[model samples]
Target chain A: METTALLRQLSEAVGPPGYEAPVAELIERLWRPYVDELRRDPLGNLIARRRGSGAEPRPVLLLAAHMDEIALLVSGYAEAYGHGYLRIEPIGGIDRRVLLGQRVWVHPRDGEPLPGLIATPPPHILSQSERKKVPPWDHLFIDPGLPIEQLEARVRIGDPITFRADYLELKNRRVAGKAFDNRVSVAVVTLALAALLERTHAWDIVAVATVQEEVGLYGATTAAYGVAPTAAVALDGTFARQHDVGEDEAVALDGGPAIGVGPNFHPYLVDRLKEVAEHHEIAHQIEAIPRGSGTDAWAIQVSREGIPTALLSVPMRYMHQPVELLSLRDVERAARLLTEFIADLRADERPVWEDEHGS
Target chain B: MDFELLHRLTTAFGPSGYEAAVRELIRKEVAPLVDEVEVTPLGTLIAHKKGSGPRLLLAAHMDEIGVIVSYVEDKGFLRFAPLGGIFPLYAIAQRVRFANGVEGVVAVERRKDESKPPALSEMYIDIGAPSREASPIRVGEPAVFVGETVRVGERIIGKTMDDRIGCYLLIDFLRRLRTSRFDLYVAFTSQEETTLSGARTAAFGIEPDMAVAVDVTLTGDTPKALPMAVELGKGPAIKVKDRGMVAHPRVRDAMVEAAEREGLPYQMEILTFGTTDAAAMQLARAGVPSGCLSIPCRHVHSPGEMVDVNDVERAVALLLALVA
Candidate 1:
């Protein structure tokens, strides 16, 4: 499958944290053909390994990308406007401002997922103060438009909910859809694995589609310890330049993936990535994460005896929302960079940490 | 109470993500004492003492609250974001030393209203550089409050004492502990001030039967302070509940029993706000029962956070008794 098509399918898949089966199944199917071994971990992380053409027990390069996206959990049932509604609480970092009037899916205990719409009172009916403010999460409810009896029977408390947004193609090879905050990076790992098939690499590749990263780095924490790769790189989304975001804090969408540097990222991996990007003429930006990257890289870095970890991010606008936008060119560039970096890794590679003076 | 060690730890620079220097100091201090020592990838220094019994993980964060340089203006004024809870009023006129040893003073942008104290967004660090190019500090650099640890009456006062004091308590406990029935894992965790990342991962790796976070907590004894039971200098505070966690009943009772058995003065803590490494440790895979032992602190999160030395000693004693 092409990058765009694969990402579209992955993005549209519903995989809220702890309940990532749908997306995990899709990934298992997509990765089975290319990988020599494919399986899911206890915590539901999808791991696929492609053997390298090196001596036995070749060094492993772990590529981590969380498959979970920001979603909602049905908290309770409420009735207003002569209709029954399901109240919600955020599963991750939901942008309350963009939540009103969104289409969503309510995953029930049985049967097909129920289609729902997020609704709030019309401005005319709301008090003067309410009109000027975004509705608090409690004030917003998912209108499945079912009667109280049916809504109560079908949707129980704590049922997982996900946003519903159509995949859109823009003028400049950009795509916008729901759950792209992560599916973009998952697609990057898939594409990279596909590209590495024709290349000669000394290091084995362990590509993981981690779960529960949106809630915390739960899957990455356990997966890294189980895999214990020689080194690792986490693929995630960074903020792209957009309104209200400063230039220093955001990267450009079409400019390519952002290679992260700072305390969380090992210096050697960062330098190697930059060198490879320059050599391959791959467009890339440098992202400085002062402390925590708030991604799987944070957990993977401290795994077991500490694996040297780096973060490569696809820049997207409007992250953690239904309509996250990104450039497909950037995704391809990120894949190429990863394939080249893995190809350049030596079987006997040893990590070198800079001294106190970083000399 | 090893005031010299407390002084050294409180003065060390180890903000949330940048814990290298502190980790090295601790690695050296505990290397000879423990059977094995390892610094986790995220910079947590975990020292293990072999035992045949159930594993007990004790976490004390080496990292402290600080600020990260977000943007450096052309005039050398650096805009920053707080790595942890930073009160603008507490920060103004304070000195901050960067990891590179470059010093800066905290100041606020002038506002027309002047009615309210400046928010962190309105605050900037003046590193005394004439231009951005001339400044030694760059964006993404971290800086902590520069304060001297000193003995004032019965109190140890300084910056980073909120956690370094906790580190000191753990170090003291490790030094004093002779033999234990429980396997001891002492973790000098990182990033507690920011994300509690260190404790969360350390507990997962160690998979301990139970854990306790040795850190400082607020006291209500101050004049006109919010009414609560904990008070400075009276005793070590045993956490019952905090904003982030309710101490696991088994662990909480164990601490109470240890304190009572040791005859060490202790207080039950119910903090209205704030949390510690114990909160994160308790949630680690399959759940590990966890609680916190707190040194009563006054003026928390300031350059001169004050902790009673007697309280520190008692907390260590209680911890040693628990492990025994």
Candidate 2:
């Protein structure tokens, strides 16, 4: 499969936090043929399991990528000048400053995705002091180009609206689009499932597309509670460097996939990933998150009896924005590294640690 | 008998997820008292005192809220996000200690107009890491206040007093449990500030019949605060309710009656905000009757949380009476 095409399909899917059925269905269609059995929990997390031919008490390897993305919900609507303006609040983490005067696609439950643009006061009409203050999220509205009665017939209170930007291929192997913060990871996990299905792996592999990660990783917590895998890895995106951004803080876009290592990361799992990266010659960078990682790993590490977990993050630029960007090389590398790591684990043997202080 | 052990447990640096130091210290303290002790999968210390009866769990989280290195700027300055709920107003101009023994001061960026309290995003810690490579501190290292426990007019002011005080009380309680009616399981849990992960799992594994969580609550005596009924020097506060979980009615009444019979000076604690491990334990398996015995302290979740030493003694005494 073409990586860019998969990314495009993923970016075009509509799945916001707490509403992930459409995206989960799309992912199930894409990955069903590649795994032994596919299961979804009540939280709409799609888990594709490929069982090893080993005996009972087989060690399970869970590779998770969240399917939900940040979007807007229509809270209320009003009519002015024969056009319907929908009041909205962000359903996930969104920068209020970037929403001004941008085109969006509102996906109401009953009708087609309607086109709209963020309506804000004209800068020239505002006083100098008023221009300096950023408009609050409540002040912004979406003009959906329809009369109030017609809009009310189609749109509802909880309709999701996403940015209308198309996926763009940038220079130097970088591709940008909305929802790439996690959809790119979803595509990578799909590719890893494809790779693992072709070979006979030693451990049981579970490819999980979790939901509600953008909110608080709620989906991964419940899915982890149910799965209770011995070892797990969450594939997600990390902040990448842009112009004027702190270089020390940013992981480079093409630098490679990042391996999260620290107190939150299991030490033995980190070593295992490092060993697999070396063996497969995959380009990988080390990211140390000493405390709670604010990711699915935070929930996964402390699941039932505690699952030894690690995080594999593809560097993403402009995260939580309409135009999140990632390098294709990094995405493919993350998939390859995860595939190698899962294939290397043994069903009967536990990952070895130097001492009992595993963190 | 071992004041040094108590001092070591209090002075050791272990914030929420990174609680190895505190866990090790508690392990040493419980080695002689319990028959067998092991660290739980969630970094909680589960010490077992063998007896043949229903299981009773006593929980004290070992982790405290601190800061994690979020990003390092180009100029080698470190920006941080709090590991738990840290008041940005109190964080400014304070000292922090890194995991690698590096010291840093958290300073607010001087804006042209500074009227409002600095947002946590605008704050940075300067560890004197000249460059990204030389900093030794990576994005995700945990840092806490660089301070030691001290006695200030019958009060103990120290870093991580929120849960470490409870840890000390658990150690003292384990030492006093000679003939137990119930099989006692004492757990020093982790990540109580971030999520109740440690206690949740410990309860699932132990499957206790009843549980009592030991943690700290805010004192009403602090100047210009809400009118909470709890106060310092009033012994341990028997928690009625908090933002997280309501104390079990049976367990709450029992604790109150036990405190009254023992003549232990106790106060009714009503925490409008914040939670304890009792909340997580309450939701375990059909449900366990759970309650919290909180020590009233000033400036909870801060580096210099103030607690009265007499309250600590009373808290331990109440636990002894409940078990006896």
TM-score of every model versus the real structure: 0.80, 0.85
lDDT (10s digit) by residue, model 2, range B185-290: 9999977887777888788788999999999999878779889998899889999999988899888888888788899999988899999999998887678999
At residue B190, candidate 2 shows an lDDT of: 78
DockQ of prediction 1? 0.23
For each candidate, report its DockQ versus the true two-chain complex: 0.23, 0.30
Q: What's the interface RMS deviation of candidate 1? A: 3.2
Worst 10 residues of 1 chain A by lDDT: A350-359
Docking class of 1: incorrect
Task: Write out the backbone clash pairs for model 1.
Answer: none
Q: After superposition, how far is residue B21 of candidate 1 from its true place, in Å?
A: 0.7
Q: What is the C-alpha lDDT of each candidate?
A: 0.88, 0.84
TM-score of chain B of each: 0.98, 0.97
Best by lDDT: 1
